[model samples]
Target: THIFGKFKFQSKQGSIEDYELGDLIGKGAYGEVFQAVHKETGKNYAIKVYDRYQMTQANKLKSINNEIKIIRRLDHPNLVKLFSVHETVTNIYLVMELVTGVPLSDYIKQK
Candidate 1:
């Protein structure tokens, strides 16, 4: 079976004209996260776009599925909220709330 076959995810494959993508915030094992702002709502969000080809080959489709499931189940103030997910032909974009805080590593080093 093909990877990502179980889940039918559709990405907002529109041009970059809708939102302003800012500086890179963090990079993880799967992909990079960026600070972004919605042009119409003026809302801030962190966009995490994963590398489709790499993820598929690595068979980490479960990770992507789990992320969506976990985010959907969570609803608490202490938790960062997941706004939406857009899956394109080559990437999966996860739109999430932007939380401003010092990284744990930075905080630990200061103390």
Candidate 2:
């Protein structure tokens, strides 16, 4: 089955042309988050790239919509802002505010 089989939205719905992606910052169960810069504005951001294969394996297809919904509603100093979403046949990209700091979960796990 195509990984996008269960997705309510279509793939390749948007473009990644505006931002130049940089180094990877973190890896999650279905994706890797990277540092990115907007080409025209030069603003920095964190972009999460979710692999279609990984999402299918992890059963996170619906989580994509859920994530976008949650991120769009968040308004807090500590939470990064969601800027946009870009996609391809095999990957989903989440453009977000660049937030620099040790993740609380990681910090706590070290204790």
Candidate 3:
């Protein structure tokens, strides 16, 4: 989906020089996801920023680490591709391919 204008999602780290973040697309218990573009390549991607503070309380760091490991191993059309991960002292940034489609809840309601 195309979101116009600038919107800042919460990031533990100040700002990286490489990416320009746009509107937020999704949020979960752990963190928020935003639409981002790379400065050099001009490639669009979904940037998932995980809140270390929240995740630590839930003891989910290992699970998140495992998920990253599995995602790195994947290579298929049906699976979402993970590009790269950026690690900070307080947050984990997962750079993934942006997939455009309706949410399952919305699709079910339509049906």
Q: Pick the candidate with the highest lDDT.
A: 2
lDDT, candidate 3, 44-91, per-residue tens: 988999987788899988788888889989899988788766666577
lDDT of each: 0.77, 0.78, 0.75
The predicted structure with the larger lDDT, 1 or 3, is 1
Which residue pairs in candidate 2 have backbone atoms (N, alpha carbon, C) closer than 3 angstroms, thus clashing?
Answer: none
* Per-residue lDDT of candidate 1, residues 14-53 (tens digit): 4334568898999988899899999988989888889888
Q: Which ten residues in a row have the lowest lDDT in candidate 1?
A: 1-10
Model 3 alpha-carbon drift over 4 Å, by segment: 1-16
Structural similarity to truth (TM-score) of each candidate: 0.80, 0.78, 0.79
Stretches of candidate 2 off by over 4 Å are: 1-14, 109-111
Q: Which run of 10 residues does model 3 get worst, by summed lDDT?
A: 1-10
TM-score between candidate 3 and the true structure: 0.79
Give the per-residue Cα lDDT of candidate 3 at 103. Answer: 69
What lDDT, from 0 to 1, does candidate 1 have? Answer: 0.77
* Candidate 1 residue spans exceeding 4 A from truth: 1-17, 108-111
lDDT of the structure predicted as candidate 2 = 0.78
TM-score of 1: 0.80
What is the clash count of model 3?
Answer: 0
